[model samples]
Target: MADPLDLFLAAPPGLEPWLAEELRELGYAPQTTAGGVTVSGTWSDVWRLNLECRGATRVLARIAEFRAFHLAQLDKRARKVAWGDVLRADRPVKIEATCRKSKIYHAGAASERIARAIQEELGAPVSDDAALTLKVRIDDNNVQVSVDTSGEALYKRGHKEWVGKAPLRETMAALLLRAAGFNGKMPVVDPMCGSGTFVLEAAGMAGGWQPGRDRAFAFEHLANFDAGAVSDLRRLDGGTSLHFRGSDRDAGAIRGATANAERADLTQATQFDMAPVSDFAPPEGPPGLVMCNPPYGARIGNRKPLFALYGALGETLKTRFAGWRVGIVTSDGGLAKATGLSLTESAPIAHGSLRVKLYTAQL
Candidate 1:
């Protein structure tokens, strides 16, 4: 067994507490810190986090940390750190560097030096297209090198090829679901579900499915990757009896969401329909939660008509979804309030270029 690596799981700003809570539930004692959660674990823990964690944007494993006043010092210190234990000697790798408040402030120079050291010491080919990356950070003359264990971010999930305008990312949806207190025991409905991210994510959790089960990770290319061992971490609990439902006004969105659900193998537990907010009908069972990432007018459309849309959505939820909770994600607070729902506000979070927040209320 290799020594425990310093694993930093990056979550969207304002969501570190929830991510830490999730890690505690997953049996890891994580120290919640600004920007990410820090946990010490081995290669298997890295693999499992990349596989099961739905809220983490990137799972970074710190391989080396040392002080280097200059590039030559940096190169010497970098070469002394163990690389063969975690990285493959024959595999291609990429280097990314960031420098702040350090004597060796040239990020590019630091990356080049480290890359050269890795190639000369470990005989690894470095390239831009490599699946493995060594993230170098220099701050206050202290250098830290970590690897992005999760490639293409955790939200890609490999099943959602089709997307709608201002589509909700899978990671944000999962965090929102967790924020909304969804335990996967009851039903979930999304009236304005773009590509069915919230619905599908909720359904997968309800079914005890691994978020990364169908995806490929950058850690698979590392030297310590154990395919047989990681395979055992997958959830074999089968599907859940609870249902998840999504409705979109656009017919194309409905079709795309259904196909995406099928691709995720979640068709048995989810439903998608081409229906507007006015047509929302609670499922046969008990009321669960109504969550939606509506059109946030950041990249797509105007905000005028969306006021009516929000109002209609609020009216429908208020009249139809009694005893059910509601969650909405949007950048404009005015639009969220336009729904006429008494929602509790969360701190602003970064989504794309716009700042958004999750509004929660009981309907």
Candidate 2:
């Protein structure tokens, strides 16, 4: 039988279809559900998904799934499974448990039970920042246990060392690029490219680069996984040369982005400049994507100036970027409306604890 793999993708409310399509593009025809998608593949395909997928927050491998009515039964089943095949005795692991309408409704108690079982029976260490994590969800007396294969949330990318205040995450940036219909063929302009996350992610995608190429994943510690096979699969090179551009009024932000690009070995693929929004322009193309996460007054502490900034942004897009697509990530709806551009679609997304909306405009 093929090595069964279950993938979990966390999306904004009403973005499961987008995630499913992203998976399909990666050669996994995922079955869509209320909050996530499920797919079956081998270990090779699992590595590919972890490397290539930009829309997913985490990818998990379902190791065991069964029904349990009590904590004793859960512990018995968890211990009965061949833990040696999946977890190394020396490597540390954390257990996160959630109970919903189940007999064992105490999440903490259940997590403790599992942790004790893994440690006492299997000799694995317990930790919170473990490279590997076990996720257990008990719903209606049915238990599903899975191991997180993607370590460090896949957005770390191991490239960005400096981040500005309220910086957009790499995963969110990639999804916004896709939502804006950006194929990475044209020059992408970020007027307020704080830390240059969008620009770098676009450059990587344009070059067909894998996100996990330089990072280590939790699944590598699993006994069933073959290190040589994973290395061989990742040996395929993503060819070179990409066109991406980012600009910010802050000279420091530009410098940070340049340094980050150099660290990611993508300096040749992206260019960073220090320029104000009023001076921003599309680079000789009608098909480029203009994406920005401007100051929203909550973290930046200046609402009045932000309105002017949004207005200036709207004026720029309306005057210079005809036929180009625009995407704005902002938490303030009023400030976004100040842009005065016709919005085509707006979707709610969570960025940390504060919920934000992604607005799309066509010019």
Candidate 3:
């Protein structure tokens, strides 16, 4: 058996606890930290996390660590580490460095030393646009090396193409759905759905599908990659009976969401319609989760008219969507309060450049 390794899962700034909870539920002991969660496991666990995790934005495999006081010592220590075990000779690599409160605080010198070490020791060429990325951090003179096993990101689930204005990321949408007490047993409705991210993710979870099934990861370029073992980890989930639904005022957004759902093979489970929030109505079934990522003033148009829009949404849900739960994501708390629903604000989450919160309530 391979020796255990320290793996770090990076989440959005304020979403570490949620990511930690998600990892713990996946049968891993997660240690929550300032920016991310650290879990220990073998190589297969690293691959599995990259393949299965929906809440994580990126997975970094901690390879080695040592204390170095100066640039020469940092180079000496970096040369002793095993680089060939993680990197391939044919595939190029990119190195990023960070430093804080350390004697060897120069990020450029640290990065160059490590890059030279990799070239001389492992014969792997270094390039800016490489497939693999190695991150070096020298905090308090402690040199730590990590390889980014996730290439692009977990949110680029390799299916979405037509994105509406300021589309909600897949990772945040999944985390929001989880926070709203959704377990995929009941139905899901997004009235102001931009590109149907929440609806599609709900369907994927219900069908036991892997989010990274369609994407290529940086782990495939590692030395220990096993084709047969990875094949076992790939799961193409079957169709689900529980229908997930979404609607948008923009007909183009509705068409794009439908195309994306079709590409993800979730057309049967997810349906998108071109309708405004005033015409929103519950599907013919038991009450379920009513969630939407509505427009905030940050990216879209003016916020003056949004009060009426929010009031209309709240009134529609209040009169028609009885006994159903609601979650609205917006950066402005006042607009969320304008809904007039008794909602509990989830902890602020890092969305693009602003911090956004999810306002949820049971009606």
Best by TM-score: 3
TM-score of each: 0.97, 0.93, 0.98
What is candidate 1's lDDT per residue for 174-210, written digit by digit as tens? 8888888788788999998779999999998888788
TM-score of 2: 0.93
Root-mean-square deviation of each candidate, in angstroms?
A: 1.4, 2.0, 1.3
Task: Please give, for residues 219-272, the per-residue lDDT of candidate 3 as tens digits.
Answer: 888888887898898887766789999999999999999999988989989999
Each model's lDDT: 0.89, 0.81, 0.89
What's each prediction's clash count? 0, 1, 0
Model 3 regions lying over 4 Å from their true place = none
User: Which one wins by TM-score: 1 or 3?
Assistant: 3
Q: What is the lDDT of residue 81 in candidate 3?
A: 89
lDDT, residue 55, model 3: 86
**Error of model 2, residue 197, in angstroms:** 0.9
Worst 10 residues of 1 by lDDT: 229-238
